[model samples]
Target chain A: MAEAEQVKVLRFWASPWSFRVELALKLKGVPHEKVEEDLANKSPLLLASNPIHKKIPVLLHNGKAIPESLIILEYIDETWTDNPILPKAPHERGMARFWSRFIDDKCVGACWMSCWTEGETQQMFMEQARACLRILDDELGGRRFFGGESIGLVDISASFFALWLGVLQEVAGISLINGDEFPNLCRWIEGFVASDVVTECLPPRDKLLAVFQSKKQAILATKSMVY
Target chain B: MAEAEQVKVLRFWASPWSFRVELALKLKGVPHEKVEEDLANKSPLLLASNPIHKKIPVLLHNGKAIPESLIILEYIDETWTDNPILPKAPHERGMARFWSRFIDDKCVGACWMSCWTEGETQQMFMEQARACLRILDDELGGRRFFGGESIGLVDISASFFALWLGVLQEVAGISLINGDEFPNLCRWIEGFVASDVVTECLPPRDKLLAVFQSKKQAILATKSMVY
Candidate 1:
């Protein structure tokens, strides 16, 4: 019998989910190939890997495709058990999942400023989004990272909040992730940015900002035309 | 110390999530006191149990409130090992979680339908909800339950779709879950209803319909005022 092949990740460079998966793989010391995807003209492999989601950050492990960035993280943590992402205690594990699911529910799913037709609908969502961040800030009170000291799974999963939120605030002409207001969370962001592992793995903030700028510009152009 | 105290469940009569926790407790043979909540004016305990959602189906085991219906299900299954809802295998368990999460994401979350305004929104959600039920029908094709012949944790978790969906469809004045279109699903619904254990525990359809009627009327009244 031949040895099984290693897992491969199909990802998009600009996607924060792609970055999170990359960070998890790196933390676990899992060696795998990364195939960058072009969202404009999606690769057949990417489409085949995740026909349902049809998005990036699809991990092909031993030829079996696992879509959903969070799902991929779980797979990585499970397969490469050396560096554990989940807690040992079942209750603690559940709590970690609570936070992860919270991020997915609050931060990721609900769009704030984007696609808001009016100031009210958009502002309401924006305020709600800010409120959610406030909860995170409180939860991260006095802690170096969401994991307390070192960067842990929840911190890794929320890496997007640190990167994209700031950029989005800039593009949308509003500040949500204010360091002064959320001292603990802000410090955590700084710590994560300065960390060697995170710094090395992170996609350039300027590049991300450029992408956000272009997206907003395109949206604005379309809005002008339609109006 | 007297080996700690047993957990109690605070629930509403007509809620499917409440029934899910109850079914798990009944299956596990765990002793619990049920606290019925007034939907009109929620109790303090209910509010304390789930501050975020402020909804029913809160499982209070060992005096600690566990909110989120699925999280509550996981807790009940974990605390009592009589009949495990989740499999020991990580992969199998992940698949179960994936499907459960999918239901929450696609159907339970009201993803597709929530976007539309009146008229179209009602029809859209109905169709989407039907598609979801049809998918379940296919999953249950030629099978007794979702977990195979005998109902398992997933089966209990998904039981809501059978009854509540029908009620919601009627309330919205749209038809989906067409019995002819979903033979297996219809059979599964009957199979669940036929099970003495489940049948005995369920609330009367007329009562449930009354509950939904009141809720739907309240929402429509509020929306009409707003518009």
Candidate 2:
């Protein structure tokens, strides 16, 4: 019999990007070993595997390294035929890619910066973030999830909103995702986190909260020192 | 006989992102109608087609719109399999996507900004742009194309460097792509723009230069008014 194809993931615990890759793997029932990296002092394997960005999560399948979480997700879906993460039709697949990129390009950074910044800057980013959330809520409409019945590409890509954004908002003492303002997205957060595959792999909420809280505290300390 | 599929592209002539979509279609021999958008006053059709971003080029096939250039390119490839722009292997396809994104996320904006900014800011962006060019040159290595013998995803995505960057650099009186510094990249650009499909679709060099020159003049006028 042929040896099982070796699969491994290089990841940091607190990254939502890493979470996306893990979720995709678990969803597909791809049994892979996980290697946690010290991002502050990255390993040689990590560096050699991904020289371009030198960032995780890098997916290694039979010694072939695939970097970038979105790219990794697509690679996994393409390689493993069962439990498809992306839709079948070309147009639907294109839309899936479009929304996934939208969440990354428009939503994530704006929402993230809204937490880290203050005063006018924070307000600017907050508005942008809110606008994005509103658009997302509209897109979700009456669908149970962004992927309809299953948690697929956009849901996986928007995993940051399902977990990290909530934690970061709490740490920063902001409420970007009010149930009233973004009812669909709020409901999505509930459904997405409670899903089995996601629940198994997500970093514990308290741990994520602690990480962001300390980071926020450090940022505040730096601001006080400067001003 | 059944009616032929109605294929259209909402585009602005000078936009490299738009150019990418056009080149892919032409390379695939897919007949398409081009509707040039008045970017200052965008049409309702363009707005309706891509409600999320409202930017071109939007590919309308049988009236189903696909927005974002890279997404459109993928859609085009999947929908029409002839003259494949992406490699057949899953890993190679993933790499193609990675490099295409790298060019967009890292190279284009930095190179464009390097042309427009001045003094310390210009120097900072210039260094970043140069670093990106060096990395791209190294990746090109000895390959006749980034696609290794034909124009493909990375070659198409990096089209900005082939035409627009050269025009912008000349207009700004800066020399970022010296033949010695990025010989492989320079050679790739030469071959890429000289290729039949690319050569046929590219905007006239003199017209592009005139457009950038007027924009630079307007920017200088605004700067002088401020400082």
DockQ (CA atoms), all models? 0.32, 0.90
Model 1 per-residue lDDT tens digits across residues A71-100: 777677777788787665545555666677
Per TM-score, the best of the predicted structures is 2
Give the Cα error of residue A68 in candidate 2, in Å: 0.8
Consecutive 10-residue window with the lowest summed lDDT within model 2 chain B: B218-227
What share of the reference contacts is kept in model 2? Answer: 0.91
lDDT tens per residue, model 2, A1-227:
99899999999888898899999999999999999999879999999999988999999999999999999999999999899999999999999999999998999988888887899999999999999999999999889889999999999999999888888889888999989999999999999999888899999999888777767767555532100
DockQ of 1: 0.32
Backbone clash pairs for candidate 1 read none
